[model samples]
Target: MRRSAPAPQLAKAGLEVLGEGVADELPSYEQAFKAVVNVEVAPRATVARSAPGASAEADRLWLEHARTAAVIDDEGCFLIRGAGRDWVRVRRTAHTALSAALVPGAGSMVIAMSPDGRRLCALTEEDDDYWIVVHRFEDRP
Candidate 1:
């Protein structure tokens, strides 16, 4: 009988197949998330809250309270998303480029990059339930 390889190894191989010029060296999830702190969030106007009965003051406060992190993939492109929003893509090689903010909903986001740096994922908790969101680098234009 043939034995299957470990999950981690299989994942790495899959990434290599999908990644764009991905290197053999891949950072672990822990390391990837830790590196997220290094990516900076550009200053922007305060975001407004769309919830019913939410006041402008509440929206301003929520924007201020929102936390953000960025995960740099193996290709040097980074994915950034804040609480209750979709991921934003930015390239390290580019300067003066701005990423648009996405629709929001997930609270207190935690990010992780796939081994080949081809995917960005976020884990969030709401009402004692956890959710995962994934964004593929190749899918972006």
Candidate 2:
């Protein structure tokens, strides 16, 4: 049998968790990331929530991507309906807050989307490192 060393305690605590039923139709981060064909890292660190420039950044992302793609926010993941004229929150098994890693001084989430609106992803800073969580839409929203 091949045995691997146990993960470090701090690493375990810093892990980004995509909790069960982020949305009934949304697959786990692992499964979605596995099927991803492309990735684009943000050019700079994302602004922290409630911090200066944060709202601007959010607006830019929302206008650029959320208009065509599904969105994942503090409330959980959901899709904009009817050509972005309306919205529908995805149903989840439990109410959960979608957050990044829980490390001190960690920057806010940086988001990226596919032009085709088939994928959305977020990068969370973890101390000096970063963790990327991806969500792939099997069909265009």
Candidate 3:
């Protein structure tokens, strides 16, 4: 399979998981759940305009957001929610496993495997249809 080059510009956009963030330590199931549950989207993202001719091309948008951000404390972890379709995504690297962070489901949750097991991601309902895009997850330092 072919993969896109790692994005260096994402850091400027505040893509924390993709940049500035380091590999975080593994967390217990309980810790992961708490972190995910505690943090919410807080606010929604405004729609972005497409380049002149791409208006009809369709684009992805953030429909809703969890109120709190992913919480990280002295504890191990806090977020691990089951996907709706009996499928929960887990990412594993040669040395560790990473659980799915965000779950965006319209019909059902999509569970995908990371080629390197270093990251796991999900799609939001913004597609109008069930579309998914996942990325690697790096542990926070």
Candidate 4:
């Protein structure tokens, strides 16, 4: 059987992930992404206790896996969810222009996305270590 990746604790260290996964009439990645960020995937039945009186509630969160899509190109990025889940496509737009251009250096990773399906992607470059550039496309009327 395939092994599932361990649960990942949420951390906003320095990662800016971007991408799009929808078209004119589909449930796109941009939509899902808006609600998901610095996401923490927890394991089912895994007990986690916070402060006192945190309440002993049943955990509905399961350790699904956490990963950001690679910046494949200027057109889009790809994300693979749970098994059998269709590949999510993060489309790009003009907002991407600002994103791909802003990191600290050419080697820093840049992530861009729009609340709308305008532009969403992460531009990755290798600096001595690694840095993140973030941008989100805004659809102006």
Against the true structure, whose TM-score is highest? 2
Off by over 4 Å in 1: 1-106, 139-141
* Model 2 Cα lDDT, one tens digit per residue, 41-68: 3322344555565444534443334334
Q: Which lDDT tens digits does candidate 4 get at residues 81-103?
A: 21122223333332323222333
**Candidate 2 deviant stretches above 4 angstroms:** 1-25, 32-52, 70-104, 107-118, 121-141
Q: Mind giving the per-residue lDDT tens digits that candidate 3 earns over 63-96?
A: 1111122221222221222322111222222322
The lDDT of each candidate is 0.34, 0.37, 0.26, 0.28
- lDDT, candidate 4, residue 50? 38
Per-residue error for 107 in candidate 3, Å, reads 4.4
TM-score for all models, in order of appearance: 0.23, 0.30, 0.23, 0.22
Q: Which is the better candidate, 2 or 4, if ranked by TM-score?
A: 2
Judged by lDDT against the true structure, how good is candidate 3?
Answer: 0.26
Per-residue accuracy of model 1 over 9-85 as CA lDDT, tens digit each? 12211112222333334433444444332334221232233445333333233222222222444454543331223
